[model samples]
Target: MGTTAYERVLSVAVAALHERDPEQLWPLLAADLPALCGGDALIYKLDNWNESEGTLGLSPGVTAEFTALGDEDMGLLRAGYPLAAHYASGPDRAPVTARRVAGRSWSQSRTAQLLDDLLDVDHVLGIPLPRSTTPVTGCMVYRSGRDFTDDELRLAEQLQPLLTAVEQQRQLLRRLDTPSQEAADVALTPRETTVLLLLGDALTALSIGRRLGISERTVHKHIANIYRKLGTHDRVSTVLHAQRLGLVPTASAARP
Candidate 1:
């Protein structure tokens, strides 16, 4: 039997939460989310316009097409496409389609024309992440045919919290990926960070191993590496030190 939409979303949620590497999450989602949300293709952009720049990810083929735009097209994109402008001007982070945002004027709008010419798509559904700041962050769902239906829009909205969870995990992974002055001396490898985070949850070596799909012996090896790197001899102190170093979230905010 085919999976229900809810089941599919649940499957996505599980897979996303299991992902340990922040860099891999985008491609993982981009692989399946477009079809789930009723679009031909999807591209996720994170803090795209920031000075520090941002990351963009999608299926490899589409990634090339999306980023190969010429200077003029790049300039046009930076001007804030309709849905991006809508969120940038206010607090609403709801997913919106280009047709809905541009209405009757969409046919003539430069942004619409640009998308058609560039992506060969007639409509876009911007799923901006929840933000109270500039440089809207999230994915854009593109399709060549009709605009997303109300049901599809609602489905996209329902997935927002899951996306937020993934983003939160991504931020934690980012901290682990970047070494600040304090953390420079104590930086843990991505695998070690994952093990440390699991340690914070009080999972045993065997449990962590099972969760990570590794042998218990390998889990112990990672745990030992984490302890040596964090200058801790045991799980409790290791997790505590990791939290202090901002390598993992605080107790209340730790992964559930």
Candidate 2:
């Protein structure tokens, strides 16, 4: 019988868990997820559970339609989406727990409506990545019709940590590859460095200013300076540049 369907899925998940390259892993998972979980899924690896800074990476044949999510569209979607609240209400280890009900759940909310209109999704499956102490980064799978069954959710729960380990290791390599000294070459001031790291954590100008005890206007000044020095345009690029320069928070440093 050749190890059965569920067993084969787990085998593939384990085998590719350490692939290190999203390019390799995304397509593999995209192909396997529908068979294993019984729905079309797109994987999102975010910077924080807060839905702030991160790229929506996917393999070649995934939901290319999501490319329509412009800065404004995504801003509204992220701000209104309930991921942060979901993190607060749900158990840390319960990665497969469902948050959004069905189309009805999102029918009432503008955020859900916005995303639903764009992506034609009616349900969400969240896999909370706990490889880090704060438990921020993870993947979410969305679908248009039926919600994922309990059994499928459980399987995803089991699979979360496998991908989590890969991501944590990938971040470690990024940090290792980055020259701590290069961050200094950009000549970011101490306060500017603080802004950069917090920015990487997906903090907004208001949040960053409040945390640093500075005015939001002052915070924007620091960000503009950072952008000018690094020659980056947006938050994602700034953080990516900062990461390459070894400015992003390491797993050890991120742990609370």
Candidate 1 residues lying further than 4 Å off, grouped into runs, are 1-3, 48-55, 78-80, 177-256
Candidate 1, residues 1-256, lDDT tens digits: the string is 1268888887877787667678887787788788888888876777754323455566545767766776666655555467767787788899989789889787688877987887788888888776526777888888997889998899899877767766765765764534457875675665667777788889999987766656899989989888788778988888888888877777887854
Give residue 161's lDDT in candidate 1 (0 to 100). Answer: 70
- Could you tell me which residue pairs clash in candidate 1? none
Local accuracy of candidate 2 as per-residue lDDT tens digits, 140-194: 6767777777777777776665565445434433432334676758876545666
User: What TM-score does candidate 2 get on C-alpha atoms?
Assistant: 0.55
Model 1: which ten-residue window has the lowest total lDDT? 48-57
How many Å off is the CA of 125 in candidate 2?
Answer: 0.7
Clashing pairs counted in every model: 0, 0
Question: For model 2, where is the 10-residue window of minimal lDDT?
Answer: 169-178
Task: For model 2, give the RMSD to the true fold.
Answer: 14.4
Models 1 onward score TM values of: 0.68, 0.55
